[model samples]
Target: MLIGSLLDEINKKIQELMGKYVILDAYYIRLAVYKAMNLQGTRKDSSITFMVDDVFYVLQKCIRRGISSLNTDCICTVINHANNILLTEYTEALKKNLSASNWTAVSQHLLQGELNNVSGRVQSENAQKKYITHLNDVESSTSCIIILHNESSEILQKMYLSDPPKRLKVLSCLEAFLQTAKFFDSLLSETLLKTCSTIFYKLVDNMLQGLLDLRYVISDEELLMTEVNDPFMHAFCDGLKQVMQPFKKYMTDTNYAKLCRILMPYIARSYEKVVMQMKFNYNGALRLDKDVQYLLSFLTNLTGISVRNKFYRVLQITCLLTFEKAEEAKEFLLIESDTERWPFTNKEAREILTLRTDYSEEIEQLL
Candidate 1:
């Protein structure tokens, strides 16, 4: 009974410290837990024999209350500090047999709390209020989005550069950033689009190296002939598609068209390689076909009418090549070679065919 009373008193002290400096208090409490468990030296063991759960219970309560009472700037500061703790301290401590679930609970509680606070602030500021209030709200929302983008970019960079990489964490962080961007776009509209566009551009630039690695794999004829499922390639492409998904709504047609053009050549080159591999390996070709199809579907949705129609024409040619029926391939070649009878104008056909050397060569062979 006396020990229980002491623990309760200690809990009250920790809460007071947390209320004073929430972010720093989290680190301090974690250190205190380590000391209380007598895990200062080589006395490390496999089990957590201390009352770490009770400590976390207290910490969770403190984090919740602190988040509720803080303003936007304070909340952002706390979030940034919490993320640092998760990435550095939590990771190291977890290896020492600390409670991972509890740490995750605390970290997630902080992140979700931050999300809720920012969301509520956005909604409240954007509510049908006075003109001066709305303007102020827009400014505040813009600042919050910028802060979240920076945090998310740090997470993405870590995930991208880590040895063997943490794909799930990278994706989760990306989704979180997208949610923030989506919210800003909905509330602030064009005022934030330029900033959002720059964020996406940087995202794609960071992922470009990974995309190039995948391209190198696809360009390898021998590997494509042997491997049935290129999981790495699929994962990378899917990730790129996911990152680009949120931008579709906010992007101007001109901007979208530019992005489509930039991406089309990569798709075309990959398709060319896949089609060449299909000549010798039917089963492996089937798997790659799905990759190409997925990319095409994504492009079709994002592209303008001119580009979409060109993709449809290319899809028609791809279908013909897949079957490898000599007669149908010859018919397609003959029809497309005729300027008047071709579905696209001669210039458009050339533009499409130039996207893939294999397509042009195959048509030339049929002619």
Candidate 2:
């Protein structure tokens, strides 16, 4: 019993000492990261930077030493700290640099000639390049994170020579970094969407003004205009497509697809609003359908997403404009009884039905 007690005390002392050592090692590693980050602020010279190299150096050093020493707790401590740093401090740093570029507003201004002076245009141009560089940095960061995770796991297998289960336990101790990589990757995608959206919607606001002019077309002109000669109408969809085209060369397929899906609903809603306001005669209603179909086809090819449902509301409004009688429009809304509901309410239906130039006051009241 005395020997057992002695062994117990020795084991406990050993653990306490290892704990102190491991904690101190992780602290120094974190300090190294902070020092490196401070030394390398907002570098645009490369996709990867000194800060990334420094962080991975310490991380690999920490994990390799822990595995060689068979110190499980040491690896866990280092990985947890690394994960925390990447998600919070590292993410904040990237976001700060990206925001400073003013990539969103600058895109619109650059295209619109809103940057007047030579110096102002040059500065804005530099800022735009910086934003693109920051995005590259994010992509490179995610790649580095993944490569580190894989290499760390390989080091575990080679050094520890453990069975699958034991290796899995150690790998789980490092999984936080994997999750951090995914998070950084997602941040890259989200940032692209935001920048692209800022440019896209700005173009829409400018171009839609010209497009809304169709609402004022005299009835005779509407039937004669051949589906609205307006490039601005095409600019509505094609402009967004144009905005995203440059980024396709930079983004991963998954990132680009997500950007398309998220932004598609906004386009649908905007087109629906514009279509609802225009006064269409019987023939102009035909032109409206033609225009909608062309835009729909263009959007489908551009986004590589199923967009028909997104424009279903616009189609519904087009149908409302085509009806020969308001009573017919009302019947169309009620025909299904309860199986499928139209997106708009009855009052909204009446409002759309009234936009048809041929619908008399009595016909409008019938809706």
Candidate 3:
């Protein structure tokens, strides 16, 4: 009876501290809850089950108040210990006894908190690259990927339903998915790729739309300046590159062809818009050549005849500008147009060259 009374008193004080001090007294509350639960004693005394329930009840109340109200470290510690206890000692019993809603809320809070930790740690340029590489190692070990796969359906549903900011927060974990794809042997990667294809398509679509929307707010001059000086385009391109990095090894030829088909039209349209705008703004000054070259450097990395053709057309226009050096333009065209030397297969090269001839007459007229 005295021990039970002490447990009750501890629970009461924990509730009081959480209600009053919130984050400031989270340490005390955590310690009090741990002491009241007395996990070691619970292992021996089945009667201590009630006390354990009371501890979780208090945690649920604190969690309901808002996960942010507690110190992150305190919450993490509590969740780790709680998960250990629940998984080992109370898994079957808790299903019958505990409130399902409370359990779910606690689980979600912990998962989201951990995911946010992963996101927060990789905000800088160098950190972002390093984190992606780390993902490859972690996924290969199956630790992070297993955790993600366990929650993937829920995460996907949440992402589909969430508002943009919330969805982006969830989608930030995509690097993990890419790493998983990279490490999977071809067959498994194909299956996961199909499952994730819609999500990736939507992500790329949204990103491209954001880039295109920049045209409305800024003049050609400001847009050029943004292309040259801002990090936004660099980040977007880098993200796409990261997404494709794994495909080189894991993607089958058919999947690669499909991916090219999906991406080519978007790339072509965006390139056309930029080139058209530049052409409209042209006044025989080479001021925008840097912008053209910047985009070209990134676009050249993409495959497909349509993309290559658009790039060639853009190069043709730039070469026609009075300020462009004829020798440099000729050299670029000669090097870039040799179908034999291109990245595509012989059959693909022949097809692209055949397609290129249709535009040849028009390009000559423009020149």
Candidate 4:
């Protein structure tokens, strides 16, 4: 009774919001569906299924008509609802003694089987095999959306992609990626870790490189320049950072080492470009606090590197930049602790870090 009432309330709220404008932002629609599904979870299957079907039906209609007022929230709610409802059902079936892997496989088959075409069948099969496949797909879709998203004002982009559109389709794909990653990470298998590593490296590589491309894509525009600035860059960076957590959680040292290897070159090239642009002459030393913090955290979280050595190396370089103009030294300082600590002589790093007026004795000791 309560579930029924809650679903009614949620539906009413969605209608009210939709009534405000000729079309609403896609996020609001999605938010409504999420709320409705949360309420439906309190009920029995028949009722929940009815709600799911209603949402799917409405969203699919909106998609065909190009009524984007339906937005990402609606699609997100639908996708999440499907996964949650199925997982709950799967768990119940397991309690009745269904083999866990069999439950997973069967559930996958059912979801994929419902699709009418070969491509959808293939995608679902791939998606089900290891959730990472879904993640990669979403990463690709998000990349595509980021390109179009920068074309106009952020508001217009939100409107363009909201509800039953190509953009929302991609956003929902991303949300599915997040949900599926969480689900599989709980299973904790070696194969799963390996698959996740591959996915993370590829996804991060593409997203980072793609964001770089986006800067040039809109290089001609003045208003669009802000789109490629810190906020946008950090969003993609955070996406990769979050995805890496599960891999770090399961495998620890080796996974972290691998991630650093995968990320280092990209990071090096990227930071090098930014660092080189900063003037090293006079008092123009670049402060790499934010970027260094992100890189170091990702490293330390993934590896068991000794903290003492890490910060000492950092302090050493910061001191060096105080006197001499060494861009290379600054670049090394920016590297994560897990990165193969380069072969900078302790003597050199110390000389740089010493920042002393009369370090002639210290310099002579190194020689």
- Best-performing candidate as measured by TM-score: 2
Candidate 1 lDDT over 169-278, as tens digits, reads 43443344345445534444442343334344444444444433443223456555536665655665565565454334434344455455655554454445433333
Candidate 3 per-residue lDDT, tens place, 1-367, comes to 9999999999788777655554444554466555644432222322223344455555444433333433333333333433334333333332333222132233223324443565443333223232222222222323323443334425434535646554444344434443443443343334334423533454455555554444322345775676457564676677667655544334434444445555655555555444344322222224334445665567556433245454554454444342233344345545655755443343432332222222323333332
Q: What residue pairs are clashing in model 4?
A: 26-71, 30-73, 30-74, 70-163, 71-162, 71-163, 320-352
lDDT of 4 by residue, 1-367 (tens): 9999999999888867644532353444455444443332212322112333433344344333333445444444433443443245422422232122232443334333456677765554433433322222223222322332233223334665534465555454435534444443343234334443444445555555544333211222432344335464466657655545443543334335544454545444444334323323222222233334555565555454533344444534434554443443444455632356553565544544333333323444433
Model 1 error, position 185 (Å): 11
Best by lDDT: 2
lDDT of each prediction vs. the true structure? 0.44, 0.71, 0.42, 0.41
Model 3, residue 221: distance off in Å is: 10
TM-score for each model: 0.29, 0.73, 0.28, 0.26
Give the TM-score ranking, best first.
Answer: 2, 1, 3, 4
Model 2 agreement with the true structure over 221-308: per-residue lDDT tens digits = 6556665475555656666665666555445455567667777777777667766667777777777777788888887887777788
Please say which candidate is ahead in lDDT: 1 or 3.
1
Find the 10 residues in a row with the least total lDDT in model 1.
Answer: 126-135
Deviation in Å, model 2, residue 304 alpha carbon:
2.5
